[model samples]
Target: MATPYPTPISLSKTCIGWTDIGLMGSPMASHLLSVGHSFSIYARDPSKALQLQSKGVCLINSQQDLAKISDIFFTIISGPPDVCSIILGPQGVLSSLNPGGVIVDMTRNHPALAREIFKPARKKDSWSIDAPVSSIDVGAREGRLAILAGGDIIQWLSPLFRIMGKHMYVGEAGCGQSCKIGNQIVGSANPLGLSEALTFAERAGLDLKKVLEGIRRGSAGNMIMELFGPGGFAESLVKDLGMGLDLLESEEERAVALPGASLCKQLLCGMIANGDEKLGLQGLVTVIERINDIQK
Candidate 1:
């Protein structure tokens, strides 16, 4: 049996804050509320956050206000640029963040960016953690996300982490992001492999669903098929692949060769360039079938 995690720390005295409530963030915030962790939030479009408001989560008017009242702030924004602008920009979190407060960034951001943000936050006697989450919106809603966190505040935030998902402390400030990049590399590559196999199977006149079921019972089965099948739209995977490409660009400076990830990136870019970016990982089959001159 797996070891049971320690009891969660009471968050009654800690004022939590969540911003950028998109698909993933909304469910995550709701999970916290369900566990009785009262927190505040700031939404760019107030209407998107009305459901949260109805749950009695205090809605603040600005990032500064959100920062002022929060002892532990969470940001689940888009990417590096948004993370930088929201935390370092004028009237951003740093402007009014209390000394010794912790900022948990759950964005799938670049590790270097996470390190950069850590510097300034540290200078002001605050802390930052790169705790990018794993799992889709559905997983977030079910509180089954595997949260990879890197920073000094893991001990203090363990209780809250428990409420969200199975949490792992990867390492220092940017390690969580580094792990996320690695995750994307595998995640993107897996779909491509599945696409090729499925295409080959379909061309051989095999039942795709039956093949998936049999494969799932073996090591060949994976989350990609479980969540997206062969033609569903995987918005998160597309975004993660884009972020992986950015990481590769940075790695090139160090003479790192990620040929596999690079190839997957090219394939995904082709899908996007062809206006099929909205299609999920399974959609890669469309591109593969086209390349092989086979009809889906």
Candidate 2:
């Protein structure tokens, strides 16, 4: 049986479901509860579901059950596979969601699949919303995440997104995912830019601490400095934070492959990311030395 096609209908009767309740989704759903939207949840790990239960969120046994009951569906899983399993999988949410419900995915995932999820959801006359959240775990808890919602279910979604976080409607589905990747591009470069600037200051024999004080006063200041703290770009962060070696390698690949970054800068980035991220962007200093060593 096919669901009646909607002319972008608005939904006031809302039951929400969260696929993953860890990190961003936990606090995001918490904010939803605070605003009085009763939400059901499912997590791969029972403990995560239990944590949401302790916070008064309704916990369900399966993804299908969540869809059957929820007027709004949301997935915050880590990547593409989890997205497919919960939605397009045999026991997926689309199988159970009532007609005219809304499905919202809050994961950073491949855009094409997100767009494809809309088809079956629409076959049942349900709509899918791509609204991957922007912000760290800290921002999620603070209710300050920036939400990027796609699809024409704007009216149905606006009030709910308002409760969840500060938000912006990017476009239709996939638009949200596009913006997320764009953000990653800029985000990868922030620390690198800081590293180069600080290196230049140090090579000039300028005391970096004093230089930072002056730069922090002007346009040179940025969030990268704050994330790395006073050591600026040091190797300590990688060992301490447990950031992935693969991600650093990916950073180098993207720099060389991505449009806009100067080739010289890309080569420099490739070397630095290939080396170590904890060493801060300043790790480039060693690469620079190696280049001169080769020349000599």
Candidate 3:
């Protein structure tokens, strides 16, 4: 019973509020501020958002306060539980959403949770969109994230989307989450394959740097290799892959198979076992190294 939200007049007229002032959210909010939008923001740690506060963005104390002032509320918090609590709890944003207000959740979320959020938002005569984004540290700072949005309101939201990153409206409220998870599943193959290839070259006494540089020019060249060539922390990958596997397990009747994703998960689990969970996707190389008994 979700309904389409009416589009607002213009960026200047649309009041924006957001939560999560962490690494990714900070730069994103900054972009919105850069455009001179009337913006308000909330953060558990007010100190984290002081820089933005000094830029004339209102620093509100709670989501409830945000809902009261904002026409479009955005959130990109830690997990589904926090997302639910922030939007559904007593003092949550949706509790006080103005008529026709919209909530855009940018967290990588479970599709089910995303759909559930749409219902209440609609009940309030507002709307919700699951718009999970992906970017590395540099891309985020540069506003080059890939935003996969799920909602009927894409056209209405495009102006805002353009400020954050490249965006595509995939489908209804939960579809963005599904697509993000699927992307994670497919992307896992890159790091896993890279790890295996590097491990093989090292065992053969080849120069690791030479092999990496050579791959950079061939059909094997990819953004993953470019981003994680020397190895970067992929702790978030653990969460992303786990979410995909959970979705698959929940939908066993679909009979879909992703053997590569399963293998990658196993390897990540091995990395976790060795207390190297803090390492990046490149750390998979270390896991491969351990498997082959390759010495330092």
Candidate 4:
């Protein structure tokens, strides 16, 4: 039986499904609510959705319920599996979303998966935009995230994008994920370099803070060092490195060589293995410290 899709609504008046209430998702959703957009949220823990609820957002019980009335559903879950299951599994978005609805996946997912989901969504008269976001939780909180969007609706969605941050329309369906992969590759690698430098400086008995200050004013200055240099989030490195590895694995057929990304992956894996996965990206200094000890 052909699934019945709801009539398309104007973007400004569209009901939205703001799924996934993680570190980044929470703030992103809050920004939408602040702008007076109607929202339907499905969170595992209702407590987390309380704040949004108080602000007139509806708390729903199931993904299907959220999809039923929403003209646009936004998902910013963790990994590819989570994204796939939410959109493709039984009673998932594809099974319930109205025909003219739009599904925007802002998760850092595999490009191939984005492309795969695009096909079925189109058949349902729905559109999918793989618009994985860049920037950390801080950026999301401040409504300054850099969004790389893929799909044909960039012009139509520009206003919504502006509510969160600046957006770049990359290309057709999966290009956003492709761009995100490129982003993770560079993003994951920078911290490792910073980790090495910081570890080396600390071992050399230099003032690490002063070292950062000195280098930040020189050619070595970068966002990674400035934002996550000494007292910044380090656990994000583990997540981003893992995502980078997953992106590389997805592109294995191409035989791309990414030694630095691989090395960062191993280091982050080592951190998880060492039970330091909970630490922020700056915790990579611990991994570097351990490696230096072994080398000594």
Best by TM-score: 3
Give the per-residue lDDT of model 3 (tens digit) for 41-136: 999889999999989988998999988888889998887889989988899988999878889999978888898899988887888999998666
Off by over 4 Å in 3: 1-9, 229-233, 251-253
Off by over 4 Å in 4: 1-12, 229-253, 294-296
Candidate 4, RMSD to the unseen true structure: 3.6
Best by lDDT: 3
Q: List candidate 2 stretches off by more than 4 Å.
A: 1-13, 223-257, 260-296
* lDDT values, one for every candidate: 0.80, 0.66, 0.83, 0.79
Worst 10 residues of 3 by lDDT: 1-10
Position 80, candidate 4: lDDT:
80
Per-residue accuracy of model 2 over 115-211 as CA lDDT, tens digit each: 8898787787778878877666667888777787777667656776777677788897777876765554454456566656666786688898998
lDDT, model 4, position 117: 89
| lDDT of model 2, residue 118 | 82
Score every model by TM-score. 0.90, 0.74, 0.93, 0.89
lDDT against true structure, model 3 = 0.83
lDDT of 4: 0.79
Model 4 CA lDDT for position 36 = 76
lDDT of 4 by residue, 1-296 (tens): 12223333344566889788878899999998887776789987788888788888889999888888887889998778888898999979878987777889999777788888899999978888899998878889999999999977777677678989999999988889878877876766777788898888877899988998998999888887766733223455555555555554665335567788778767777777888767666667778889788342
Q: Rank the candidates by lDDT, best first.
A: 3, 1, 4, 2
Name the 10 consecutive residues with the lowest summed lDDT in model 1. 1-10
